[model samples]
Target: MSPVLQIALALGSVVGLMGFMAGVRHLAGTWQIGSEVQRKLVHIGTGIYALTLPWLFPDRWPVYLLVGLTLIVMLLLRLPNSRLGATLHSVERQSYGDFLLAISVGVCLFLAGDQLYLYVLPIAVLTLADAAAALAGSTYGTKFFRVEEGEKSLEGSAVFFTVTLLISVICLMLMTSFAPPNIIVLSLMVAGFGTLVEAASWRGFDNLFLPVGLLIFLSAHGTSTLGELVFLAAIFALSIVAFKIVAPKFGLNAHAVRVYVTSIFLLLAVTDPQNTIFPILVLVAHIWRRSVAPCDSKFPDLDVVAALVLVSLGFLTLGKATGPTAISFYGIAAMGMLMGFCAIAASASRPVVRYPMVLALALALFAIREGVVRLNPDSANWNGPMWPAVFICVALTALGPMILSRVFATHRVVKLTFLALLIPLPYYVISTGF
Candidate 1:
């Protein structure tokens, strides 16, 4: 059969299995498995099973049919639960208008596919990493690590990074293996950077940002045909594995220090490929010091710095791909600076704006600018001129607060300034077709 058909079949079978599992659980008298253990088992199992489906069947009809049946069953099961019932009922009552916007966006993304990888990476990060962090934090977290915006445990961040990194590495390796050797390193850099963006993200917006950001990055970097598909499969498998391993480890407070230490080593390896020896040394030292080191204080800020650096590298890699366009280069630099400032400000203040909100605003601004550029008529390429608009925005956003602080002598104005920065988003989206 055709490749598309095979993908369809695989996806279909997976959806069918999920629907079956839900049915079986509902039928079994032991359905009240209310613990995190049970919930995680179901999620992990379903995710793994789903991830393998595309590879197994590779047929579209079966996949679509299976997905349809699964949705139907889910609706049927939720019908009896009052909360779910109410939500579904509300959804049914809503006008098509509510969905039109979302549908349009989806269509646009589908059409843009490779062209929008950079814009989509942030969304993917939000979805996968944020979800992992919340699950890990709520379940296994003991000692709380405070950031400028809020508190997350070292354990939570570790879980988040582990999941993001593993998924990224596997996908990137697969993609790179089939691409030209020159571009392979660039792909790896993109994945590593994308993971960092996810790690630093807050709230649930990482969900949206991660995928969108990755999409944008991939689009800019370009991907080989078979390699891209294989890479996608790797992401699915890695996500499942991360969820399964980390979910169960949540209760192991005794191992938190070990886990954190190991995570730091892995993160270091990701950020600096040349210093492979350093992570080994760090790992040995951490293991040796495990018993003596205090676990009660907080996760080191070094990990955060590493993540930021990776993101910067990814942007730089993309900039390199597009040649030295003054606007594009500067735009990327500006955005990176803005993100760094936001992160710093969030870390410093209590009751500061949430990290996810800040990331969303940044992403939305970047996307709007890109979309606007793509709409330009004079460019031979459909994609807009490689202007440094995003970088410029980032710089202005980041520095606006510092400038205001130095001049107006008040940080309160920083919020307003950031808020004002959002004005360009709606106009850009509406005019640019998404």
Candidate 2:
């Protein structure tokens, strides 16, 4: 077959499937089906199609071509003149969730190479788990917590975690050579991360946060013994049960307790048992100080727990990264904490980074102190190359965004998140002299 013809044929098939979904959406709406119900159908159908990407295209270029084209089309569909624009675009205003969703698939394709599981894991979870969470929540949701304008329920989150857990396990087992125990831990960790990212995400930004994050962090860390794996799984299960048992007392957001336990389990998986205290201690303080039920207020402080998850991830990353690479982890971790502050500050409709800069500086200082204590406590190597640069970069990156956020004035969380991810690239480049 001619290469051009094959490419044309492949692209047509993708567009055709999308057209079919659009037709279904329209027909369903005309038949008096709810818009939200039709939306979920499109969501699941699109997701099921996404799973076929690794198999549908023989190479990465085709994946890129299809995804890029889809993204452009989706963007155009949001314009005022488009036929279905009114139905497709949310009535509220401009929503970038669909845009981010396509971009995430492109990113997973670009970076995944032969690691199909890595690409598939995030997409599948977002598709199935997220859809399930939404469907179950909307239908059965009773106890409420706030996200943009809607309230997410405990029941829906449980559905998300269950589905995500199943998907993660299947992805790991099918794609990797890992044993049962490692698969269990890895799946639990990935599911936990997805839940938090999904919970914290607003305006469909979870698409970006969940997949991009898993792409970076969700590798199968091997477990040495079945006994150790069993013990690890036991702790994870107990933590969930404990939270469910106790969360009612505080009207806690399930996302918080869910992510906190995941952090501890992941930290235990990656880091030495000794260094676990810093992250755990921080979690304890967060929980201990919450005297009121999280749901007492019309709005809950979602950022604090979500930000800690990112920081905990940074700490865990350090255990895996080495030498020059390890040095980059500090800056990444600092930004993780800073990103948290930005999330919180954005919720209050404030110019967050202006004040988040203080948190950034404090975290930088803590990083420095931890570095001093951990690396060279015997000697006063206060003049190290990495810590100094990390401090400067952390401050500059955290505050620099304040100006940009002020100017942009909307979607600061999304903007700050990408900025935070970018801040570490230079450190990696400089470290490798790339």
Return the top candidate by lDDT. Answer: 2
Best by TM-score: 2
Q: Each model's TM-score?
A: 0.37, 0.63
Q: What's the residue-level lDDT of 140 in candidate 1?
A: 89
List where candidate 2 sits over 4 angstroms from the true fold. 1-10, 91-95, 110-113, 140-148, 154-201, 208-218, 222-224, 234-391, 394-434
Clashes of 1: 68
List, residue by residue over 292-364, the lDDT tens digit for candidate 2. Answer: 1121323233444445444444433333343233423433444433533433333333445436545754575
The alpha-carbon RMSD values of the candidates against the true structure, listed in the order shown, are: 14.7, 7.5
Model 1 lDDT, residue 106, Cα: 38
Candidate 1 structure lDDT: 0.42
Model 2 RMSD vs true structure: 7.5
Q: With candidate 1 superimposed using the best TM-score fit, by how many Å does residue 186's alpha carbon deviate from the native?
A: 5.7
The 0-to-1 C-alpha lDDT of every candidate, in the order given, reads 0.42, 0.60
- The TM-score between candidate 2 and the true structure equals 0.63
